[model samples]
Target: MATTALGEYLSARRAQVTPELIGLPTHGVRRVPGLRREEVAMAAGVSVDYYIRLEQGRERNPSAQVLDALSQVLRLDDDAHLHLFRLAGLLPVPVRPAAPEQVDPQLLRLLEMWPDNPAIVLGRAFDILAGNAPAYALFDGFQQGPNLMAKIFLDPDARSFYPDWDEVARYTVAGFRLQQGRSPDDPRIRQVIEELSQASPDFVALWDKHEARGTRMTSKRFHHPEVGELTLQINAFDVRSAPGQELVVYHAEPDTPSATALARLRATATVESPQADQDPGQPASSRSSWSGSPR
Candidate 1:
């Protein structure tokens, strides 16, 4: 990626947004495309001079708090926000060599056994290494990466798939932050960050918040095209055989509507064999089995 000055980026983003976009009124024909320096300074709660110093590169060392404020005032997205912090030299994810993670052969069979539950093994980068029939059906038509982060941020269908998209996205970023912290040197983690940061504006904005909590087991809703709507509970477990892999299982109460919906799904969905790379709905995106999720 090309490097740009932090101040330069701040200035450029400032010029691209309009005052009206942020609830500020415009009185006459405006010469500039975006907010004025004074307006940005006021919104960010920094002195005009201080803000100017930042723009001129006179002040390079901005605290996290200050960057957050400026990022808001600039209307930057999650990816852009994180990029700003990196430009400011604030996000320090050091690179170190590490061993590649391997998913156990036995776990694949276990995932297949769970006909009622949606189960998958996620790699450190949240890649869906392997999933059961129900899990594949649950995510039908949406496989940006077959990786949670890519699916959430890169796929247009994600918003429809997730009812509480924003909330879930926040938790997703928080979970990624925690995992990245644990494996700063993992190349897969770095790859995920780089790919999403470049592709998704939302990911950029949410990432640098340093959200440190991994997603806990929680009940969430999904709008399944075949089944209408279903609420499923998430269960996350560390894969004992794989150092940075996680196993996520999803299920509903036996008698609940969700359970019934899953039953219907199982009937129509093909139980894909590992050899079924030619499965009609299985695209190249679903080819990799790196494990990750918001579970």
Candidate 2:
């Protein structure tokens, strides 16, 4: 019904926040998704009409105290909190476009050095800007392009790859939303959203929900086709030298089955392993810079 960005976010977030999450009871005949408008209004210490207006795009520029209260009620993480401020035009600093999408030569070399670890560098749009052999093996074959958002939503195998598919999808969309804060008119963001919306209903629903998720270190479980179930902690880092680029590394606990699987994957990897360092077109294998040859 022609929603403003703020309104769409508030509405979707409200839907995802369960009554029990914020200590509300399961009342009978509940029809609406997530916490009710009245419940949110009461919890945020605002009038019901005001809350509705905020969700409907009739109200914007909420005071810091009000925004903080709403964030608490919705259980938003730190990244989501900043995104909310940015959406309301509350952030003090002027927003700038993400730095030019470039992966330093040294950084690519560093990724190759981590033979045992599955590491990848992600561009702003979640494209696999570069990755090591293990990281490439982890993703393996996916019909959807290298962009993670596309693979998660469009690929047929993602459901089995990620045990908790719904949760992962939500977080991915939220991360994209957080990126949106940095560049409002980024064509890449718009392109991904439009294509995914038409291709996957799940993406459409999650995107409408407006969960602003900042990239953070977290644990994730994957059912690897080759290695069975593996629990790995995702270490996400912002490249200080190149803003908007993330160096993500995967770690499995020592002495665990997952660790053994990782070792096996490393052992199998050879000097002739597939190159995951760049997009499909330009393979790094034939290039002159071949010092770290996937060993």
Candidate 3:
């Protein structure tokens, strides 16, 4: 998906709403299903030619007033409105080298001691900052390198690991889009976006949707090579005082086959520190032998 501006987003949204929804009269023999460009221009108090130019990417910049008008005319919600403003360059620029939040020592201790729990700590940009032994063993294949986003987007094994590959891909791209919107100026994020855009067309399509999401609760179904299939209840908790840092932990439902698999994995567990496994600067809680990189 191509990076879009406010004009393009507004125009696309307008084209999706029906005439009746917006109280517009459809004249006889209408060619387009939704409101026409002329109708949107009239509603937005702009010229049809200008609206066309905006939609075609000929005009990239838009003022706050115009964005407000367009937002009102398009009936966009607060999040959508903010997205439009950011894309238009009407909002204040995002801070550079975003301030890292402090991680709670308690949270850190929990992750360190949970030897059998497949838990991982992630940074705002989806960096696998840390994980316990089980997490390392479960996702070791994707952590061979330091980058998690790159592994999922570039590796083929990811499809086999995730039983619902399509849903996983969509969620991953959506997460990336949310990050891109929040930190548009981050050089690392830009490079990741460019790489994924080139690597996966599916990612490109989902990225274009401008979906915004943060690390939160989600259930995942994994087809582990060793464990077969495991359905887990995943909970993501923000580490208090740690801005942009989240702890994502996976738990198997009680008395189920997945629970049994979890128990078996625990029985075969081996403890390894992130520093011992990898190099300096990476957290040990996230290290695993599958890919052999420092957490």
* lDDT winner: 2
Residue by residue across 217-275, what tens digits does model 3's lDDT show?
A: 37888877777888888888766555556788888889999999888766655666453
Q: Which 10 residues in a row give candidate 1 its minimum summed lDDT?
A: 286-295
> How do all the candidates rank in terms of TM-score, highest first?
2, 3, 1
| CA error at residue 185 for candidate 1, angstroms | 1.3
Q: Tell me the whole-model lDDT of each prediction, alpha carbons only.
A: 0.74, 0.76, 0.67
TM-score of each: 0.62, 0.80, 0.73
The regions of model 2 sitting more than 4 angstroms off are: 16-31, 34-39, 47-49, 92-100, 215-217, 270-295
Which candidate number would show the highest TM-score if scored against the true structure?
A: 2
* lDDT of residue 225 for candidate 1: 80
What TM-score does candidate 1 get on C-alpha atoms?
0.62
Ranking by lDDT: 2, 1, 3
Error of 1 at 213 (Å): 0.3
Reference-based TM-score, model 3: 0.73
